[model samples]
Target: MADIDFGDAPAWVAVVLAGGAFVISLLARRDSKKSAGAAVEAVTEARRASDAGVRSAVAAEESLALQRQEAAARQATEAEAARPRASLALHWQGGQIFHLVNEGTAPAENLQLLTVSDDAEPLEPFTRLGVGEVAEFLIMTSLASGAPTALEFAWDGQEDPVRLRVPRSG
Candidate 1:
């Protein structure tokens, strides 16, 4: 290369200045690339944290829904267990024939027969009697032989036995 003459400085000074500017530009570009990479990493970390939070919220909502369903099922079971049940009713068939009827929704368990009459023995106990079922008993002594009397019996869900009075036969 040929050296060019400047007004007061040597041509080598201009070459050195150009080299220094090139190096400065290269360093600035490298710093800019580093800054861009750091910004991208920060954005990626923020997005990951947001996604984790959203997943946690969704899981919490699902758990709450399951708990609500369990509570509803429990309430339904309790209501079913508390359904209305009716007591037994006594009906007259004839002079010496009398029958008991269960007029309830649920079955009666452990029925005991108690008779106040002196001539007949107590009837056998029943284990289970379904709804609208009729159980008959034929008393050997006629109803015309004795005055009006009452019979007491106990069953499931009843703490005290109820008295059923026998009417006078015609």
Candidate 2:
């Protein structure tokens, strides 16, 4: 057994402890820098996710608007197809003769001619005027005090009478 005595043991111990503390502080600082970097990366990724969510919402709204427009266009086309189209015109053919012609896709049923005069009798040439069909009528302009400027006519299933301008004799 050897007996040893050191007079400066406490000083050596304090120096060693200070060296160990310095090393530990350096390690802690490195760990803190790494944690800060990770936090920044997490925040950046969250911002990207939020931007993508906003873009998705905008795209969804645009798609919904397009769908509504398409639906409206489809409804308009359907209404146009279902509605009836019947048109009539009056033309002068010299010598006080007039022609009533149907220039429409659908037939005009129960056709009746009307005039502005209250006492004037309504003239009906045909029960049904087919498409592109013509009916002739005589107008006694010499006997009447005033020639009709416009002629009104109506048919079955019509809501209102249609007025047609009478062509002037040249």
Candidate 3:
């Protein structure tokens, strides 16, 4: 057997050291549990904040898409409101005259005129006519002496060729 020597430490000193070490171990275990619980709470809070941010981003994207749709609709309406329309008529008190007029928001383009009478000469074509404009043509034949004559006009709306008819008006 090996001989153990305790020069100055007594038996009571050993007991006191063991008891203090046990108390310190218990306190350290309790503090570790509390720290672990706090860490779990922090993780849960971070998850919640991330979820809220994602929801807010989605809502903002949807709102921007709706605004784009509204702007497109407004542009379409404005385009529809800015198209030209043409009408032709015959007028006379002591002379016969053909009147071509534009009655729309925009100018008429490439306007060609035609009269139903077989003896009338071919009329000239107008390149461009503004809104509320009047183009007058002299008619050699009297419109009041015969059956109603039909007037036809063809023009461009920048999309498709448009045509309109007017009954004889004297």
Residue-pair clashes per prediction, in order, are 0, 0, 0
Highest lDDT scorer: 2
* Better-scoring candidate (lDDT), 1 or 3: 1
Query: Which candidate has the top score in TM-score?
Result: 2
C-alpha lDDT of residue 154 in model 3 = 62
> Of the candidates numbered 2 and 3, which has the greater lDDT value?
2
Q: Write model 3 residue lDDT over 8-101, tens digit each, in one string.
A: 3565577679899999999999999999999999999999999999999999999999999999999998876654444433344334565666
- Write model 1 residue lDDT over 1-170, tens digit each, in one string: 44465553656787889999999999999999999999999999999999999999999999999999999999999997788664688777887788888888877788988666676676778987789998887655645775447778788887787898765566
For candidate 1, the C-alpha RMSD (Å) to the true structure equals 8.0
Per-candidate TM-score against the hidden true structure: 0.45, 0.60, 0.52
**Residue 50 in model 2: lDDT:** 97
What lDDT score is found at residue 128 in candidate 1?
74
**Candidate scoring better on TM-score of 2 and 3:** 2
lDDT tens string, model 2, 49-73?
9999999999999999999999999
Ten-residue segment with the worst summed lDDT in candidate 1? 1-10
The local lDDT score (0 to 100) that residue 28 gets in candidate 3 is: 91
Q: Runs in model 1 with CA error above 4 Å? A: 1-82, 115-121, 142-148
Which residue pairs does candidate 1 place in steric collision? none
- For residue 78, give model 2's deviation from the true position in Å: 8.4
Please state the error at residue 45 of candidate 1 in Å. 51
